[model samples]
Target: MKRGIVFIATLMMLGSCGIFLPRPEFEKGMTERRFLRQNRDAKISNLDNGKTTYRVDRGERFFVLATFEDGKLVKLEERESRPNWMTPQEDPEKRNR
Candidate 1:
């Protein structure tokens, strides 16, 4: 009975690894102004090529990057934040010197 319980618990944990991610409100062709209004605290970067990159940090290792052109959202992607050997931690100030 104990072995069955342990096996069931392990399976449950592994099954939850594929939790679904909700669809984001920002979509293609969304105007920059509208996006800004919806996400007041969004982080945005202006590029020299008239393209903009909007970063969405979910306080996790995974994040989203949205690219805009002609003042409209053109592309969106999910990315993983990996730490490099030079800076093994996410916070640079907290890294081991």
Candidate 2:
């Protein structure tokens, strides 16, 4: 009887895992804007596994960078500027200067 109860409990727990889990979906930087606006509070600064992310700020304006893998935003990194390699490509005026 105890063994049966344990098995049933285990099954119930396993079943619940699927119910509450997040569904996988491909997301892009532009696409995540909606989610970002919706969840302005408790915003998701980073997200992985192909989903949306939000970058929150105290001033209500936040910067975000969506990192893609295979054309999907597998992750999001928040920062003031794009990571690495400051070059003329980033700022055309720099080339003119």
Candidate 3:
């Protein structure tokens, strides 16, 4: 019985892993304005090539880079592999060091 319980618990833990997996947003064809509204506090850098890079502060020591062109989101790259479930309302300095 104990072994059965342990096995079930392990299976449950493994099954829930997908819930924490991060999904990439900011795919091609998304509007820049909409992205900006979603990431309201993101730090933005405008490039000379008419592309803008938005540095998003993801909580728990993570961040993401989103690039836009012609007011449309063109690219999204994460600085590290992590979950995208972090809340934007989190304090940047405290969680992302």
**TM-score of each model, in listed order:** 0.56, 0.28, 0.52
Query: Model 3: residues >4 Å from true position, as ranges?
Result: 1-25, 81-97
Instruction: Report lDDT (CA) for all predictions.
Output: 0.81, 0.54, 0.80
**Residues 7-35, model 1: lDDT tens digits:** 99999998887686654687899998888
Ranking by TM-score: 1, 3, 2
Which structure is stronger by lDDT: 1 or 3?
Answer: 1
Model 1 worst lDDT run, 10 consecutive residues:
83-92
lDDT of model 2 at position 62: 42
lDDT of 3 by residue, 28-47 (tens): 87888878777788888557
Best by TM-score: 1
Q: Judged by lDDT, which candidate is best?
A: 1
**Clash statistics: count for each candidate:** 0, 0, 0
- Candidate 1: count the clashes: 0
Writing each residue's lDDT as its tens digit, candidate 2 over 11-90 gives 99999899887644324443444444444564554556764345544343346545544443456555565344654355
